[model samples]
Target: MRSYLTRLLIVIQFVIIIFGLLQNENRAFLKQLFLRSDAVLFNGSLYRLYLHQQKPRDSMLVASHAVDDYSWLGAEPFLVIAHGLGPKLYGGDNTIKTLVKGRERGFRVYEVDISLTADNVLVCYHGGDETEINAMRYADYLAVCRSKGQDPCRFDDIVSYARKNPAVSFVLDVKNRFYDAYGMIRNAVGDQNLGKSFIPQVYDFEQLPFIRKDGLFAGEIFTSYRSALTNRQIFDYSKKYDVKVITLTLQRFVEQKGDFPRDLVILTHPVNDPFIAADVKKLGARGIYTSYITHRSIPELFTSALFFTPLKQV
Candidate 1:
């Protein structure tokens, strides 16, 4: 019986060793796969993706075009100021003034309209029914706002306001289900120049356009908690479309770690804590979208001017 017990113990040890080896091999395989993917190649590098292929003069032309046409040149890091709700719900004027101030300080401001009224007007609000808004025209919404003692301005008026103010760039957050809203915005901003100035972000996947790289609205693909696609899938989609920026949650950023494409711009919630911000910077985030930029007058927090200082060298 003692001899049998010893044999059983030996078998158990052998099984444990096999399991350990398998685990190690699995981890190594995953590491190799990640390396093969080349997802993290552009981290901490200052290389342009399309620069090598294009000519020196042509590259400058493209850079200038992106800056002038695509809203790239104004600042190192872009500041996307989302005005939540209307003037009645939140202080709308205060939000606008703060954004204007940010733009004056050379930060590009993208204001999102989130209200879902039937008229589908873009006056700057958060999370409303897209279907309802598109059903109602912007003209009707203006009348409704005036009746309610609110400022009445058409979506075109907002674009005009941005045009008058050279520093400010508008990110029109279309929170409606109307298929033609994208084309409507393009037509409204007659000049291709003005159309290019606007970045239209869509929350619904069905609403997303197949070819959005050209024209007025750059798509800001919103990934919520209930999103079906994984971080890698989102990154791949963005790369395929040459999408310059993507906005997602802080939790998703942590989970994905180095999986995100280096060329894509990431906009996440502001990390208030300096340590957290430092870590986020190391992870290679382009910008942090927050109301903190409005509340905090200090420019450094909003701007990407500060370099990440290493606590310990890699």
Candidate 2:
């Protein structure tokens, strides 16, 4: 472990020096880099470095079986969630255009934020000041988005799209309002559709009781981004509730120590850096929630952890 840490630190320092030198050489280039997404500015570039330094196998895997429409692996070539629709142009805006762009990139699972409007309607949003968001009706919010040319979408809009495309799935991040937002989604999409298309993320272990009682969603993901629980406690609660997936921030996972059962799926968030992604995989994380990483960027990194097997193994 000591030697591993030494090597890791060396690699990180090398990356920083390389980027710093490049930035110093061309200030205009740095400004252009600023225009890219958060993942692109650092993580994506780091991933390019990883590809060069560590020559992972360069091959594509063919699907072994037909897509399971009810499962999360309908079109998932990689075990990644497209954070905020995955489009750099309007990333985290949660609009129809963003979803389209993410789909174009072959992303089958998307993580989107949803909040309630003034009239108790659920809309895809990541707004601060919930009181202010709660003061605007659905129509008022739509008008505001149009005035800003954001092309916003509601929770229902996403559900409608999902019904049309059964291959796609959504991971809902309702922030702090887990129960209220989930109730609204259940009503809008119905329990059957909710089971088929949506995976609700629970923030706190306290929400597990409600999850157990409701039993509407087919699966649930416990995201420890805001939760105060330790990794072991979270893993226990997840196992108790049959929540198969657990997501933690990269820093959080690195800090925590414990063994997660092999059957449980572990994922880390906002991992666009292939070096960090590989490190987390060594630590037992099976997947990631990424803003910019895609199968096209590095297919080799995803070959091992995919949900489906390739028909013809090389």
Candidate 3:
């Protein structure tokens, strides 16, 4: 009878453990579903998905590295303006106009390409021929520009622009997917010997080491994911690379529920509510990314202030 009772107790414990595991798995799956749904909702329409699908794909390791260094150096908060469909949709003049206005308004600007390709050429436009951009080299793209009037501006041109405007920094968002293309961009950017006069901001975190090696721009990387595993993987990568600044979508930050490791700068879209912004700051976020600064303009509403006020003596 004693042996039988002991065996039964063991079986009950095992079942309880299994049930807990199943519950955890279910919660994780639900969280993932929610994240995907939220991403679609945030875009506001299925048309946005199609628009994103049509963009170029290229690895942006160099840009990622640049962002990392910039954050490490403690730069001011800035805005990232995305230009879609290349220079044809929004010409260089329009693009420059927007960037100039952002600067005049006391904001820094970073431009990202929408296309992804193997050559990993990150230029000033948003979307391009994904198939053609990925299949051909940057040089080939230049040739097409000369022949077909497709390419808008060169990376070097942006560098020169940054040199001319000392107060502004260029954020290059590489939309590429291939990893090797990152190295190609680094090579094109040349050795880090370029003085601080021409450093541009890069937004990819994976390219931190390359940019550090290249010695051109000083910026930090921004990465986002919909799943916990991917987020953890990125966090691990950041640790290994010693990255200091990280960017996440507002949804991801909320879903994590204050579980994110602290002490690093967290950048996210601006929130208008003073309470919510205070909550987010309480959760350890360091900066807010916004289309306009007005969203977070409340004075004396920081997280630290709310939590650390001295108590009156009784």
Candidate 4:
């Protein structure tokens, strides 16, 4: 691994020099570049590993088998997040228009953040760092989003649309720890007969025990991985519960890891760069979880499963 470290450092140094030369004024662009640099560094090192593969086709990223593709069902493609109408970073946050755009892009599964207003209403809103959305009720929350021109809507607002489009699915990333919040969301989804259409993306592993008590199936819901769990523990949890799990992994864990289970999907926040998608695959993940919508997220899978070709591939 000594040579690997050397190569990584060299790539990082090269990236810094290139950034200095560009001298762009946009802070968002610069921030995105810096975030993507890790993937570039990791992918650069991966080329070396590929040069010395131990088996025939061991280096190829293209997975022919459905199970190896990070999909529980073989028939559908697993690349899920497409925020807003377009894949551009400077787009609206989870708008109805964006959901329509994701469908236009051939994505069946769309991830949306759900925050509970203090009055127990679930709304589609992005949870800001350190911001507790549940502290406010529907009126305050709606005003806040409207003030920012975010075009936010209630969870039921989106689910009603899902009910209309039978093929579409929504993965709800709940932002509230309130018991009533869960109950309200469950009621809204069930009342619309869209329970199967919506999937809960829960954060706390400690809440797993309460999942069933709260009316949920382990295999149906996904866990948003935290630093509290190691890669091995994450793998074990998914295996035991038969649930899909999402892990936040930077380059530090990518190249060094030797194996990964098929259900463990690796997620990177605001993944503007597409190379990170390829690198995630290199880490043996099922797919990637990203907020920014882009077909280039995983060009290989994007092209292979274009239009989610078959309804049931398994």
Candidate 5:
């Protein structure tokens, strides 16, 4: 009877474990367990995307090295982590909690993906290529995302947080279009004279004059160029506008033998290679964006025995 009872208890516990895994309320918590790269999304019950890290690193090994992860780059050549504390580093992306944690870890500048809802409310989300999202109301979007185990960051919340934490700065990456972008932006700005604290990224050059008309959004505008021809045009037009930053996709940045365009703050994304990081440094990059900025050091950006080798921070 004792043996049978013990066996039954073990089976019961096993069943309970499996049941919990299936009905898990903490999907975000579960993501930290199997995440290979930065973040993996589980849409309620259907989707399971394993975002295999571009170069897989052991989470435990990375976590163990955090304290001594010799930070090489200070303010200049400023490091901006796209979408807040990289999903891999913080177990999620762009959440108010994750961003606050990043600031605690000494990260100052953050790039957040922004979109305007059907109700004219600006919300924070990286809904690129998700065409259906264009039609959803703010509440509807939030509900669907939440029901799908996603936490949507509110633009108002992020703005307020920035106001409270003056030391921290934000780079708003416009993910989708808005009807009255100026009003939405000004409303987000609220009372914070976020002079240098805020930088608005624009894709269309025509939007610049309108955005600048407010005067409150008087910070340097960040724009990108597709072709070399477009690059030259933007450069020429920049002489008339206050476009002070140029962002290039990491793929394009890597294609260049030398560095990005000089004189402006050139920031590239998802750059994980030390060789590339070093080359960009030599090319006079204003900054490099990496998901592992907190988990690893930029090569040659830190003091190490192998002068050029960046020591991993995990």
Candidate 6:
């Protein structure tokens, strides 16, 4: 009787496992697991069935090394923008030290948060209350940075740095009062380099017309994290404004992957994991805004097999 009961329990557990495997909530976990290039004993009919369910007639997934794994990313080369000057190496985000470190590591593009002071000075800062920071005078802001042992960077300093490194580009994250920030930058860098070097990130479609009317900016990237527009509206406005790249949160990307136009370059933010980055890239992300990943680390990231070779259906 004991032996019979044990066998029945084993059968029940097997059934439960099988049932869990087929559930929708578990599909994502299973997808990540089976897609791993290093997954052992995962090459049988079960793998084939999962692939078939995800897409009816896609190519068979082949396991390959990191070098070949990202080959699908295309010849354009994946661009990485240093988030807040690439992760507080010298101090916190938007500091001159971090910016210099990012540039040394071969990052030509950087995202800097620009806050306008009460004295109407443009500075690289993102902290505390936006209104309170905006209300403080430039001198007072500098004093505050000194008190906190943080290095403060002004727009003038950024312009000077850009003048020295002409190839560098800045993606301005001006939370509110974008027009004021734009005019200040234009005044500093001149109208010629306003759009070329200092790219303004518009929060919504309404802000586009104001920036677009003057033709002051050469390019504009739609940062959709804060946007309320539907995917269709986002795509439509992108075309109308000639926006070449659109940025959204990773969660947003996962939810609206099918709605986004594949032809456009879609960028996602704050991806630190090489595995997650690989996953998103395979899903059609062209670039990422990261704090840890850089041009210098790509080869090392691959050699270590952090980006595992999945059972890819070609």
In candidate 4, what are the lDDT values of residues 1-314, reduced to their tens digit?
99999988878865775676577565555543443453354532332243342211323222121232223223534454554323423336667766765666566667677777667677777666425675776888778867877666777778689779866666666666545666777677674335556655655444444444433321344442332333454456555554555544443245325365554554433344455555444445444555553454344555543232211110
Report how far off residue 253 is in candidate 3 (Å). 0.9
Report the lDDT tens digits of candidate 6 across residue range 1-314.
99999778756754665676699997665444443321233332344354342211223221212222122223445778889877675677888888888877777788888888887989888766767776778888788889978888988888888778767788888854678877777778774543466667878655666665555454667887655454455676676555667887776676554356866778888787777777667666778888767757765543323453432321
Better of 3 and 5 by lDDT: 5
lDDT of 3 by residue, 100-180 (tens): 544554454443443334465555444455565667666765565566454456555555666566554444455454345
The local distance difference test score of model 4 is 0.53
Name the candidate, 4 or 5, with the larger TM-score value.
5
* Model 5 vs. true fold: TM: 0.64
RMSD of each: 12.5, 13.6, 11.6, 11.9, 17.8, 13.9
Question: In order, what lDDT does every prediction score?
Answer: 0.50, 0.67, 0.47, 0.53, 0.54, 0.67
- 1-314 in candidate 5: lDDT tens per residue? 99999778756754554455676595443432322111222221121222221211123111111221112223444464544544435545667767776665556667776777767777767665535546657888678667756567788888778778876667777666643655687766855356445666666555565555544543544455322223344455454454666666654444443434455566676565656565565555667665555423443453222224332222
> Which whole-number lDDT from 0 to 100 does residue 250 have in model 6?
75
Ranking by TM-score: 6, 2, 5, 4, 1, 3
Error of 1 at 30 (Å): 27
What TM-score does prediction 3 earn?
0.53
Q: What is the per-residue lDDT of model 1 for residues 1-314, given as tens digits with 9 covering 90 to 100? A: 99999778756754554465468666554433332233343321211232222111312211112444444424565443533311223334324544544454344555556343454444443423545555666566666655655455456666677678655566665555445556566666777655656666644343344225354453344543334344665576555544557766676676666466767777665344544555566677665554434324444554546666543311
After superposition, the stretches of candidate 6 with alpha carbons farther than 4 Å from their true spots are 1-75, 191-195, 300-314
Weakest ten-residue segment in model 4 by summed lDDT: 305-314
Q: After superposition, how far is residue 187 of candidate 2 from its true place, in Å?
A: 1.5
Better of 1 and 2 by lDDT: 2
